[model samples]
Target: MRPIRRLLVANRGEIAIRVFRTARRMGLETVAVFSEADAAAPHVMAADVAVGVGPAPVRESYLRPERILAAAKASGADAIHPGYGFLSENADFAEAVVAAGLIWVGPPPAAIRAMGLKDAAKALMQAAGVPVTPGYLGESQDAADLAREAGRIGFPVLIKAVAGGGGKGMRLVEEAAAFDAALASCRREAASSFGDDRVILETYVARPRHIEVQVFADSHGDAVHLFERDCSLQRRHQKVIEEAPAPGMDPATRAAVTEAAVRAAKAVAYEGAGTIEFIADASEGLRPDRIWFMEMNTRLQVEHPVTEAVTGLDLVEWQLRIAMGEPLPLAQAEIQLSGHAVEARLYAENPAAGFLPSTGPLNHLRLPKGVRVDSGVAEGGDVSPFYDPMIAKLIGHAETREAAIAAMAEACEGVEVWPVRTNAAFLANCLKAPDFIAGDIDTGFIARRLDALAAPRAPSAVALSAAAEAAVALAQDGDGPWGGGLAGFRVNGAADPAVRLFLDGKAMLGSPNGMSERSVLADADGHIVVFEGGEAIAFTQAAPGGLDESSGDGAIRSPMPGKVTAVAVEAGDVVEKGQLLMVLEAMKMEHSLTAPISGVVEAVLVSEGGQTTEGAVLARIVPT
Candidate 1:
């Protein structure tokens, strides 16, 4: 076994920091490589040695293998760890690391290539007797052939990109009539996203749940499963929350499924950290026979913290050890699961704004203190559009699933981020969902209630009061009676001098509460922001007459800085309420703007392919 004296992480954000944490604990020096945008990131600061990779664009920086390799050499890092994204799963990169004589803290490149593609992975799994979903894996890229296979598999089939992941390049065709168009669309997206248009046809599950097993292997021919995590709480196929020891999973079902995962890993001669994802048909609850292989992630997963919480194991440490040619730490019988653990991902996005990426300076950020928080950005840092907008991961562990859920929700509620919005409120709402709280959930849980969950709420009286009080405290001296106690609480006068405030242009009169349960802050822009119930309410002091500033008219504006991709109508065209007006692409995700009222298109201010700033009017409409 070779010892790794120094380790370099070829990624940034929480992933790099997480690996560095374990590496430091193991008495290894840690090196960090960062892009220009992340030069001042926490990971860089946490490293013993930091190297500049390249510019802010991933192509110029993180994704460039040569730059990372050079950094490793210069930093004298004897080992390299691709922390979960960027080049983490790239087989070529892994091979390159090994070729350069540095230890690669991951699965073998052959294993990665074997399981990188879904169709190929399924074929291999089938050979190894691992259960895979019923599908077509024939080497046929022709549309007609795919449609024929779909018909054979029967209607309500899934046309999924063989190279796709993260919900891209996937379509559910409930009937044969929609198969052709969906296939074409799926192929286009697949080609654009993954550079491969080949797809596979699978029979659709009436109800599906996402469950993945954390597996670890070593070079010494030993492997074991670290139980399972239910990541069914997804939106757009992106996991929002994850929990270990899947809820409603019986011991029998768990054994069968986890054993299959381990078998699949061993079949590839896998090593280090990897996740075997499965799609369970939840119609009859989680059953061994009903679970089928989806795909395998050949690197550490984002939800690894949840598994670590319950398993009481440092997975990264295991990865490092296995990479150093060690055997599995414990046999299957000795590995044990303790308590239930739940994790919520707090992302820099606005749930009410259709979950659009909210990129800006954090300004005021406060994660909950009680939970185990693995954060990417700090209070003074910025959430750039160049990378993933996940601000932090909050993990909660307890004796029971119910207690873990409650603890996770409470932690989410305590999260306070301002200016740049977050999905904390939506996460809390999801935790409170009756079906979710009861462990009755599926992959479509978020989509089924998106409208209600994403709807913007009115500021509460208590929130407004606390915000105005915070504003008063910042605007005036602290010796006044208003600053001494509750601003609007009158000891011996009429309660007529309440503060006037504008919550995003909604005029309101509120009594400032100097002492309140919720967190309140007055920003540098002289605006009052209240944090409570996992939502941030920003209030501006009302102008003389509460001047109308909102685009409540017919102006369709871009929610964030982005490039306009499409315009559906010309000036003067009659449009119905809720009709698609234009499409904006920001942070690599598209946001469709629609008409607010039945109106005539007054003007199209932004052309397709043109860059626009946040809140910029893209199109204007005049009500009929």
Candidate 2:
């Protein structure tokens, strides 16, 4: 280990800010590397010094280890912390950092490689006596071979890319017929994301609980576990909610899993922060024998905050200390677990619209006040398509899981983001769900109830009345209630002033009343966006006798900046309503664009392999 005086965080967004917080506290100067798209990001301002790596695209920016190393050299940084996503697990990057004589604030290159690939990691875990999921890790990449293996294992098997993480290169195939297509999509995503299309098959745990134990080791060869986290709440295999001290984990089960996790970590000579992920058969109610190892995350996890909340430990501080050749702060016996904590990932996406990414300027942003918030963007910041759409992480801590859930629910309901959609209401619903409250959950819990959970929320009548009152107060051309501008207005005697307002374009009456807090905001254009129940409902005042209106046109435009992967329809092709026209890959996920109405394709404005910016028309469907 080398002395690290100046640290450069080779990443962006909240993770970079998070690392900078610890580095600053430790009396180390922090440096940040940003892309052109992130030139104005808060993370850059959080650091003592910042450097520009390249343009917006990750290929030219964050993914280029050489550029990061160059930034470190230019900034006189003696250490590099590859914060979670871009190249956190890239063995080559770790090696290069060492070769450049900079301390790598991560695991050793050998450890990263040993657990980077799903197949190889599972093999290594099995060899170390860790229980692994019954599946296939055969070396052959033939489609036929994998399909045969899937049949032998059974239907409803999981197809996972060998190098996949963050649910990018994985698919759940429920039947034999869908296997081929799922395999192809998985492979395409795998190649695009990890540069490796090789996949592995796993027996799908119908009622699965995603359990991972946080492990830390040091240069002195001492290791310990920070208990475990339940990351079972997920959508499309991506974790949405995480909690520490997994619900229903008995004492025996905890001991078994923790010991197994330590064994896995010691096998790789793991140091710093790592997580040993496991999949449990929740159908049997979280028995020790039913749990099996899935894979090991070689670097810090996005859900590390929950672990920190429970154990009162700063994992990043431990990483820095370990990298500085220090011993483990405490042995396993000395480490203690405290209160329960829950974390909900707030994303800039529309849950009702198939969870498509929503990109725009955050005209109004208000995170919950009572909980821990890890945010990278501010009130006027833009949520662009150049990176992950996660806006903030809200964590709630309490003495019990139920209390934590309640706090988390209230926090989620207090979120207020306008112009851009969010899944805040959806998260609140999950927190308050009867099943979730009872601790009866699994990995497929969100997927099974996605439709009902994502049902669009409408402002209540009381909310309308509140908005109307605020709008009237703001309309007086003055501030607050009972201003001199409202001198001519009657307060109580007559029928309350009935003002026509459009709630999301639907004409409604804002029952006039007194003014309230700033919970309801009126934009410069006099359009008021009401924040209630985690929903941001826009209300624009209608003219004396008219109302405002909006509609979707027949043009199919890219939702955000992305690469055109497949063009399903061409010019002159007659397509029906909701026909798939094109597929765009953005932020490591594929989005399918469909025809709005039955029509003939007038022209295809973009072709396969072309990069497009937000709102660029890919095709025009002239309604027939």
Candidate 3:
């Protein structure tokens, strides 16, 4: 066992900061690797030494094993920690780190390789006496072969990429007729995402709950389970919220699943932090017999904080200790789950706008003090297009699940983010929903209520009045009301002065949704973002009379900066309302542009692989 005197973090953002904090607490010097775009990132500033790897694109920087290794060597780092994303689970990168005579703070490369492919992992689990969903894991890629396999598995089967994750390269085929088209799309996405077009078929559970157990192992051949987390709240196969001690999980189910997880880890002689995910049938309420192994993430998870809250253990610290060849910190029988903890991922994306990823400067960011917030971006920082759009993670802990949910809702309502769209309101709504509050959750919960959850809500009277009061305050004094000495000034019997405001360029009459009430104003930045009763209302000062500033006539513009990946319509093509025109890939998610009216495509301004900015016209249509 070699001691790591200096540790280099081979990733960026919150995870980097998280690992660095633990390393510092353990009396180790830290180094950070950053891309050009993240030169001033919080992680870089927090580390003892910072090294620039390459350009902004992940392929040239974070995913490049050589650059990261060289950075470690240059900084004289004795060890390297691959935080959750980028090269964390890349077996080749882990092996390279070991080959460079540096300690790797993760699972063994052999274990990663064993669990990298979904089909092979499932087969391995089955061989280890772990239950798994009925599926086809054959090597045949022939379309006919897959269709036959799907038929035997029955309808509502899932066509998933063999080397896929994060919901990319996955599709649901509900019937035999749609098998071919779905397979082609799935293959294309899989190839684009994982560089592997091979796929496997599985029986889709009508109502599935995503449960995963955190397991830790040491080089001394000891491993222990750290309970379970429910990650069922998701959008587009990406986790939105996670909570520890899964609601509605019985002791029997938990024991059986956690035991299986530890077995899976011991089977591979695993070490460090890893998660073994399973899918539970929630239609009949979390039965041990209905649970099936899903996948094993051979690295720390994004929602590790929730596990820490319940276990009262810092997972990153444990990771550092285990990497130094320490035995398991706590035996499985000794470790006990204390309370309930919930975590919500705050992201720079608009749930109402088809969850399109948003990129811009964070003009205002205010998080309540009560919750545990892990964030890398500060106010005035930019959420760039070069990486994931996660802004922060808010964690709430309480003795009961209900109290934890309530605390999370309060945190969501109290957070103040502006300019860049976020799903904060949607998260609050989820926590407040009757079904969710009752612990009736499944993987499909968000999809079933997306309309209500993502729908734009009318601003409450208090919210509108607050914005107008803010505008009035800003108008009275250029700097602020306090600086101008305009406190407690009210004219007697004067006709209530009207303050006109515009929300996202739409006119608001300064009337509250229910009642009109004058209130003290907070300093505004010519823009006001108010979170009231778990809803976000945003507006900026507009010219008198709400002057129309439409960009153009019949122009279909890109809503966010991205590269065009596909153009389905030509310049002269006639299209119906909602007809596909093009696809824009931004922040690793695809947004489809559709026709706004039945019209002829007058011009296609952007071609496939062309980069375009927000509000840039991608096409022009002539109304027919």
Candidate 4:
């Protein structure tokens, strides 16, 4: 294969941006393919040439192999790089690219097809002497047959779709009564998601730690493994936090797992970068022989940066070289790892509000310095409801795992995402959790601690005080309506100006100058409030307090920006608190918004398909 001159990225978002950076560093021209929604995305702007492939949905854009290939040909691209999601792991896409005389910057079509289906991959692993999870992979699609098989395997079996990922088309059957429903649901989801209802049953191994090994191969039959990553911190079977050099892995276990990963890659005659995932029972310390092969990702993974951090190797560089017919640059013995790294996926969602996806114009978007942020959107970019809501990947590297965790937590705290809801604070809490810090993690870690993780920690009094101080500062800058400073001051005023401020769902009393003391004076209209803390008031009133205080109950608002797909309720509709009221489609997922309190709907401020920014009122409910 000729050296890649122009590479077409058949994906969008941060991964596309990431691949472009690597390609540029390798002196390769980059071609970006965007959907209608992503025409103005950062990834498109970063590329040497941008091509519009199709409409907003992924099926029309990224998943249309013909469109991607056409764009590559139009852009004069010699290679196609499928970054992570979309059609990244599609074997058909790989075959088409190879047939079109363009280099595929990933594994061969054979390897991809072999590992495309979870059940097929498991069978291959079992034949290759790789330990496989014990379950039913038989070709019986009858729900009754599956339920019987599940009973034979015992209770607590996991029914997973054979053709998809991201926790879709999967169900856990806890008991016989729930088996049929679970199986039916799993099949329906499978059909909907992957267009295939075929599923396999696996005996659920409780408390298993999710780990995966990154393996790379070249065209010349050379391959190497790059340790493993701990992806146990997950919710809904989707990874939230990932780290390299799995926290409690011993040397022997690491070597064994790495060897197994290398064997798995070599078995497929794999080329380019791939990951062999495994589930390990961490109830016992990671043992050399206890890990079972899960599945192989035939393309680059979202959490690849953690692997990059420890190995000190640019995996994308190797992918480029291998695509150009170069042999692996290093042998198994030559590869070395250092330092631990952690990555937190910063999503445009509110953790306190059921992780509902938020969408809107991002205002005051300031990413943390001294931390690596791989993002596809900018400060003013809208987090479209048509794509993934992940704002950025926050990565931190340090000499030790503990240090790395600390750094990641600090970085998350330092990040300031304004006007959009995000899970930054939740991520910080996860990093600081005792279980996470102690390295006691499992796939259920996040779910088990969901309550604690979702509990909103009230901002400290000091922080509120600081906000008050800031208000005072803003008022004193002559920006307030009381420009002459006499607005807050009253000649022997009888009552204090009772300005009300709502923060974290609680109302607080403060004066115009940011003073919260009871001795503050107020006008008869209560529109102007004086804050007295026995100290000088700092800020003046900007507008009448009634206008600001009129906003209803302190419901947790949408955190990210998004559009309302369906308003489930109407004004005056009585809803049980926490009942689904609407569906907000953001970042490609439908988030069901529930009522915050049991009440009659006061107003339905937003309708279906209405665009909403963070803090925009969708609906209000009054006490029943």
lDDT of 2 by residue, 348-414 (tens): 9988778888888887888888899999998788998889999999999999999999999999998
* lDDT of prediction 2: 0.88
lDDT of 3 by residue, 405-461 (tens): 999998987766666778888899988899998989999999999999888788876
The TM-scores of all predictions, comma-separated, are: 0.90, 0.94, 0.93, 0.83
- The sequence of per-residue lDDT tens digits that candidate 1 reaches over residues 365-417 is 87887789998788889998778889999999999999999999999988888
* Global Cα lDDT for candidate 3: 0.85
| Clashes within 3 Å, all models in order | 0, 0, 2, 22
- Evaluated at residue 135, the lDDT of candidate 1 is 81
Order the numbered candidates by TM-score, best leading. 2, 3, 1, 4
Candidate 1 vs candidate 3: the lDDT winner is 1
Model 1 clash pairs are none
Which residue segments of model 4 deviate by more than 4 Å? 476-499, 510-624
Q: lDDT tens string, model 4, 1-624?
A: 588999998889899899999999989999999999888989999999999999987767878899999999899999999988788888888899999999988898999999989989999998898998899989878888988999999989999899878767788788999998677657765665567889998888887988899999888888889899999898877789999989888999998888899899999999999999998987787898778998899888889999999989888898888889988888988888899999999998777768887677774365667878999889778887778889999999999989999988887876555456678878988999998999989998888889888676654443334334434444445344332223222223243353455543346754333432222222222222222211112223343243333344725366446667667789878888678887665554445677767888878888877777767777778876
Minimum summed lDDT over a 10-residue window in model 2 is located at 482-491
Q: Ranking by lDDT, best first?
A: 2, 1, 3, 4
Give the C-alpha miss distance for residue 547 in model 2, angstroms: 15
Q: Which prediction has more favorable lDDT, 2 or 3?
A: 2
* Model 1, position 567: C-alpha lDDT score: 75
Every candidate's lDDT: 0.86, 0.88, 0.85, 0.78
